[model samples]
Target: MTRAKLFSGILISICFGLFLSACSNGESESKDTKKEEVRTATDAMGEVTIPANAERILAPNMEDSLLALGITPPAQWAIGTTVHNYLQPQLKDVPTIEWDLPLEQTINAKPDIIIFGSPGSIQNGKYEEYKKIAPTYVFKEEESADWRKQLQVMGEIAGKEKEAKAVLEDYDAKTKEQAAELKTAIGDETAAILWVIGKQYYLFENSRFAANVLYTDLGVTQPEMIKALPKAEAAWNPISLEALSDLDADHIFLASLPNEPGLASLKASSVWKGLPAVKAGKIYEMEDPSNWTSNGPIANNITMDQIVSVITKK
Candidate 1:
């Protein structure tokens, strides 16, 4: 072959090789894109087949759990204009979703997976319909009040089990340190949480909200009045002043939402003044009720700080 002809032939071969290499890479990239692992997650309702790469997750009432995992979901739980207000700064831009989850609205959000805080949150037997829209998981009712179990399930759904475990381990370490400091400061002095809404009064049980941080995580002792009560329900149970006076706790953390009826009158009552915590001037009125009301990882941490600061200062 002539030199020029040989050179042209070599150029064509080079171009053809380049084209084949491109095709091979395209195929490999496409295969990698198609790789999606599936996982089986069991909850109170049943087992759900979920994608390991699920994005656009909707945890509704479990926004606290998702926040704990460092994931801001597409939507958080809403009741009209209210939600977990303590999480507002982190969730400010995220949209609020309804508890009822109107079919049209839920479909519009295009969630890849939906998680409920508890089975009771699945109103009108909408679990099957929700499954049609996306993989749905409903936790047991008990998990609603537990931050640890809530985060574990959230990590499982997000395929971030390692991240979740790390978050929990960190929280445990901090809780232990705080608990030790609190034990040293308090020295067996007991505490109690009281909430007044409308005309009714409530004594927070050991397991709910910030009380959990005080009693369970921090090992703070609950007054005999609190320990003797029947196991508390998920919601705050009501009690009368006569019953409340039985609590001789050294410290009282009184929580009340803004403008809640009868609170002013209750505070003015002689019965309230006669309580041991009040007489000793150990009553701490909470300025922001969210610390005690919103039960989540973040809230618990804040609650721990608040408890330690107030108790140690006094």
Candidate 2:
């Protein structure tokens, strides 16, 4: 009878062990499910649920903020064959999808979420089609316009709000330090940013894109011509040669492609040649215009460094 009792006790102990193992496995699965659960966020498209821990994100044109937050998108934004060259250093291996986000390509990318730069980026009636592939979040005009706000929104969507705050804090600190240095180096000298593409001459207004870094952040004085111009309605706001001739900047950062016809025209024109900045030989020609034309901490930092280098010759 004692021997029989011993055998029964051993069997009971084995069953208990099996039960605990099953319970542990169940708990692990529950934890994993919680990790992958969806949460709602209010965007330009209203409240939408997105994965709490998205493994693959696709944000077109908004790659600057995503990259600043240390997230490499599965697909980069492109216009035809053109991609943002400045971001290629980090996104060299990522595939390109059209700016409009094609249906077949969206399905193939298999993104956990799609963050459009602006509501306008959602072309045609394709919002529903994209929703079928993944949760789509569209940034409002205000959120999309300011890099800092865009970065924070990206963090909230990706469950990294703390990280976004840290990035902004660091950026603010850098801007303060660099702005002080620029003030000391250049004093109150005014500057203007001119981007030449083909035959167009687009001037950067006070708050446009990276101009905020120049006029607002770094405390550089805006030229009378730039100040007098109306707020930019488009990304590339062009100025007539007649208006450009009135530019009164001490320094001009001229961005253009090598051998661009616009540069030739500006050089040949007596009016352009007579500008104060050109006559003083203060025009700094930039072959690569990516950083100046775009916004975000990464792009703006590169821009600040270039500005400091050129102005200070350091």
Best by TM-score: 2
TM of each candidate vs. truth: 0.88, 0.93
lDDT of 2 by residue, 1-314 (tens): 69999999999999999999999999999998986798888888898989888979999888888888889989998899888888899988999999888888888888999888787878897898888899988888888888989999899999889989999998889889989998998799999999888888888889887798898889899978888888877655578777788889999998787778888988889988998988998988878888888998888988888888898888
Question: What C-alpha lDDT values do all the predictions have?
Answer: 0.83, 0.88
Model 2: ten consecutive residues of lowest lDDT: 232-241
lDDT of 1 by residue, 221-254 (tens): 8888888887767555688877776878999998
- For each of the candidates, the C-alpha root-mean-square deviation to the true structure, in angstroms, is 2.6, 2.1
Q: Which stretches of candidate 2 lie over 4 Å from their true place?
A: 3-7, 10-14, 17-32
lDDT of 2 at 29: 97
